[model samples]
Target: MVLGRGNFSRSVAFRWIVSYAVILLIPVALSVIVYSQTREIVEYEIKRASVAMLKQVKYIVDGELRQTENLAAQLTVHPDVRHFLDLKAETGASAYHIYRTEQQLKKMLAANDFLKDIYIYSNALDSVLSGETYASARMFYEMKNQTGTFAYEDWRELMIADHAGQYVQLPVKNKEKKENTPSYIRSFPAQAGSGAAGTLLIPLNAEKIKTMLENIDWVKKGQVFIVDPNGQILFQNSENVEALSATYRKWIGRGTSTFTDTFQGKKSMITIESSDTSGWSYVSVFPVDVFWERARAVRTLNVLGLALCIGIGGLLIYYFARKNYDPVKELVNVFSLRQRQGTSRDLDEYTYIRRNVLETIRERDDMKNRHVRQLRVLQSYYLSRLMKGQTDRNVPLAEAAMTHHLSWTSDRFAVLLFYIDSDEGGTTDLPLSQFIVSNIVKDSVEGRHAIDFTDVDGTLGAVVNVAPGRADCWKDEIEDALAQAYEFITARYKLRFTTVGSDLQTGLDGVHQAFLQALEAQEYRMVLGEDALIWYGNVKPSEGSYFFTVNDEMILLNLLKADEFEKAKGMIDQIVQRAFQRQTPLEMAKCVLLDVATTLIKSIPGPEQAGVAWEEWRPLKRLLSCATKAEFHQELHDIFDKVCGVLRSRQTAHAGAGIGDQVAEFVKENYRDPNLSVSMIGDRFRLTPQYVSRLFREQIGQGLHDFISQTRVEAAKALLQTGASIDDTAARVGFASGHAFIRVFKKYVGITPGKYKALQ
Candidate 1:
């Protein structure tokens, strides 16, 4: 059991798995924390949104109430009304003088939308005047009977009494529509302790206030209420108003504007917007499940998203960890001395691996020169493959590393690369020359770092294990050693060799990465001069490569298809120029240029439709062969020029044959849209408005706007003949109002819509 436990605990694979599982829990914990913190924010936003909407209702209703109160005060002290109530009128009220007061009342009633009717009482005359005419108490009561209750057996007693009370809502009918009208009463003779000269009564149109509430910006499923200053519910939309009325009254001025409370066994969110002018409150109550469901949905989505991420992230972590663990597993299988020579179980995994690798190295060094040469060839080929992938599978790094006596226990590694840049004419192809160069490089840096050598494509690569406790200044030390090797090789052999180095990286996989960066930096030799040493990572720190994105691909294709070849080519020019100016390696530059070339080829419609010949095969292969930046840019431009010609023809073909008919058909189908004008059609077909209008006129034998107007008016004729009202017909045909519809209908049909409908 102790031996088994030691093997398990020392496993690198086990640690990786534990680390992967631990990493996946980060997002899970973050999702929980984010959901808890954001729920309160969501509820506050809901309250703030509700309050903002209700405030508009409050403003409109409050303004109406204040204006009505002011109007009532004005009517009370009016000259005609005061003359009728004068105590010095010895012969009592004159009929003609009272006629003016009745006319004023009628005008006020007609102007105000909220007033259903108005009544004025005079104690001196012992008569009540109303909006219409002088009427007896029986006649006035019958006209406004349902609106309010009057406790007057005689007019003098009724006029001198104060009728301060809540507003009353009564049903008022007009044709088939029945709406409620609420009544408000105010006393005149504005004295503290004096007899009331009369009373002014106004029956407010509650339907108008409800209409104001209905115009609230955001519609929430809720009950709306209008409460007066006295806490009386003037109007409510709930079916069980009596049940919720006490709750509404209790929650008012509860020191908080919005809160959740249960009413009639259902929890509700109450939002209150109080009016400043009249002290009236605009209140909305909605079921929590109905109104704030978005908050709950957010929390639910967060949980589901967290679960989904854990599932996906767990699989991804395991796949990567298992894949990365291949090297260690292969190493144990290949060179486990404990398994091969039956060593003691007391030896742990690392100690067993180190002993096996050291014994193998001893055996390799004892081999003959022929065997050594063959081994070098195999190591060179396999290590060269590492230049292409992070971990090359051609030869397992574990076996190659053990056989080559490469460092197996180091924490950091980097690359030192050198190449014969003076052979720009491609003259040198000597195998012995690369062999000599590799030996000199390995000899110079061998003592300072553990080194392994690989030679491919005439470039010598040295993989170095950074010395322990030397990670911070490893770059400077390695570069200094490489500088000495470059000088010795060039001065002695007249070979202008440029050196490249990579930043120190971690793990066995990092050796592969170090090889890749060295190769990428090799491409920048001609751009930065043949003698310059380059670091791929430090090319441009502040500005990253300006590579083409998905949006750029779409824009380039759109411009090409529209025959905006000038703009498309300009975009390509910008992409290439900006990427080069940013001083990145040719990898990003190649990818960006290849993408632009592909999009340009895709923009060419087709062979038969393009009326020309073009080939998409081997296009990118040609791009990759360009040796220098100038040659690469020129090749991409050549492709652009060819595709541009095909696109111009495509654009011309679309404009020449049936474009007019297409525009005319589109207008006929969408003439009901008020925004369907020349510019909209031009944008749809990628033509100027003038060009589209002229083509439409030539094909359809009418101006574009005139045809649209005629089509709408023709449709209006059918609706009008069906007894649909003029305004409804106008709106149905997309006219802003009946007036614009009538004007256009007359211009097209040689008569107004009304006249045309009558004739139809």
Candidate 2:
């Protein structure tokens, strides 16, 4: 009995030890679980809030950038700036003109302190005129000539290569000036042709950007970076902080909005927000320990409470453990239910933890998938902005490539615009045919390229990323792929396609230029005709002026004046044909057509006398509003036909030599009168002096005033040769004075009247 009691007492002691250990362990496990779970939740909230706040910062910064871009564009197209840029100085322009241009630039700069300085490099003047100084273009060139430090030539090449809108240069401090100001430069006439004028530099104050970033509370203890699209670091919060670490940069490059990674030798939460307007990214980084502080305090309290409960009472320890465990079990049950429904009764505590862990994994995967989808949408948005020349320069092309899941044959990119010409190719669905074609093209050229096809404006635009050392070889491959796609689409859906591909450009930086070239190539159909794959290189811009000259208009006027309606119509057709074929500037063509319309309106012989209200048919507004060349041609034809109709109706009212005959008759009849000039004759015929002069010249083979002088000199010569006195001859010839008569007589006869008389 004594041995059994001793064994029972030992067993009871062992059970009590085990029970006490379990009771003590519960609070610790609960504290750890609570701490871990709370840390995760807090970290998540911080990341979300940080990312949201960065997005707001992006919006504000993007607005500022857009405002800057607008200011640049506004200054570029400003009438005063353009006028100054277009002024050509043979040697040097007048001081007043230069001073006037300088004053205007000063006013523009004075209006905004945000702009450091606004300078216009005028190729015409061979000068760089700005608020600071009026200097030669060579001086401006030398100012940027830091050779190895900054490749001024490379930036110049980039600016010249781009003609889309504005070519942007990332900030770089000028070593010569000893100032750390980061300049934002924009080249005018964005898609600068060979006749590119110059660039406009707006060196921004770094402090302004720094102040803006400093005002944001999210990045108090953390770091923030303003990065360029090319992956260049524009501005950073901490100068001591090294370049972006590969681990953190990897997440950023992949375009992950919020990610956790080790940075600066500690775990950090990174949040990145990119601007659609400027193609810049705002990065905010905070240490992981920031959110863990609250959880750590709770952990410390739990540890002290457990230590206190150890000596206080076993009942107290049990109550505390049960209280903490209840919430833990409830939390576990919530996740466990999501993993496997209606199995809570059979599941142990370990099973609950496992189920919860598995559920979190599944949720993470779902979130990843959604993030991937969002990334693709962002990629599309990025490309569209590139096409529109609105891409932010703060995001690296490599990062873009990662985010967009792009793989290219070469670094060079070319934009191909595929236009669907069929009216009923894809049933009632407008995008069906485009979708079919895009897919086929993508599938056909798989592995050799990276391409994205989306509707740009109304046409299907395909941006093809290709690697081409020799353009001809690449053209063949591109043509083969395009031909295959065209043939397949045409055979399958009976849809016709006209594809225009731009020249290969260096990188994504040139996408806008490539897109613009593709658009320009599309216009070549006006010259090259339709149904061919038009390459931008093949459609070399036809150089020289496309403006309608005096000779061209005079030929048309002659045909109209002769009542040759058919010929006049043919002439109109020829003029428009030349304009279309030459690919004349739309504005220039509109202006030429307007000129033709005005000429036609003026050609109507006495519209007032013919009872025709010609002013009612004011075609200037309609001509000015024309958006397309076709519309211009149609408007031109309408004006021509209307004007010709009016002329045909009034043909009998004013026949051959109508106004010319009357003007010449009046000039001859009143040639002796000293004041009988073209203006006097014009007054008699109710015609403009300019028109009277032109009419008299066409009919009489000399100007009316010249004929009058010739007649006066002829009369004086006859009087002088016939032994008439110089004074009598001068008076009879209607000379205002004797000296005036001698000057005119000597000019025509190569001798004074007195000298001529002595010779006779």
For every candidate in turn, the CA RMSD to the true structure comes to: 26.3, 30.9
User: Clashing residue pairs in candidate 1, if any?
Assistant: none
| TM-score to native of every candidate shown | 0.34, 0.34
Tell me the tens digit of each residue's lDDT in model 2 across 1-760.
0114444333323445467778777875776677667766787788887887788777766776667677777888777677777666875566676678788878867876556676676656756777768877556656643445556666455434435443254434364544444455666662345656766767665666777777877667788887766565667767788886555456557563787777778888888887777666778888877767866787788678767766665676556656655655566646644555554444445455666687779999999999988976776677788887887766777777776776654667889888776646444456887778889999887656668876788788877877545444766877888888888787778778788888888766788899989888877655344578888776655565856788877888887876667888887877777665543554565567777777777676673523443457657887777665577788888888887777666653453476656766665566668787777776676554665677678876888777788888987888888899988888888888899899888888898899999999
Candidate 1, overall lDDT? Answer: 0.70
What TM-score would you give candidate 1 relative to the actual structure? 0.34
- Summarize candidate 1's per-residue lDDT along 251-279 as a digit string, tens digits: 77662388887765688777887776656
Least accurate stretch of 10 residues (summed lDDT) in model 2?
1-10
* lDDT score of residue 43 within candidate 1: 68
Off by over 4 Å in 1: 1-32, 87-92, 146-150, 153-158, 162-182, 190-194, 215-220, 228-231, 243-248, 253-256, 273-276, 279-281, 303-760
Clash totals for all models, in order?
0, 14
- Taken over the whole model, the C-alpha lDDT of each candidate is 0.70, 0.70
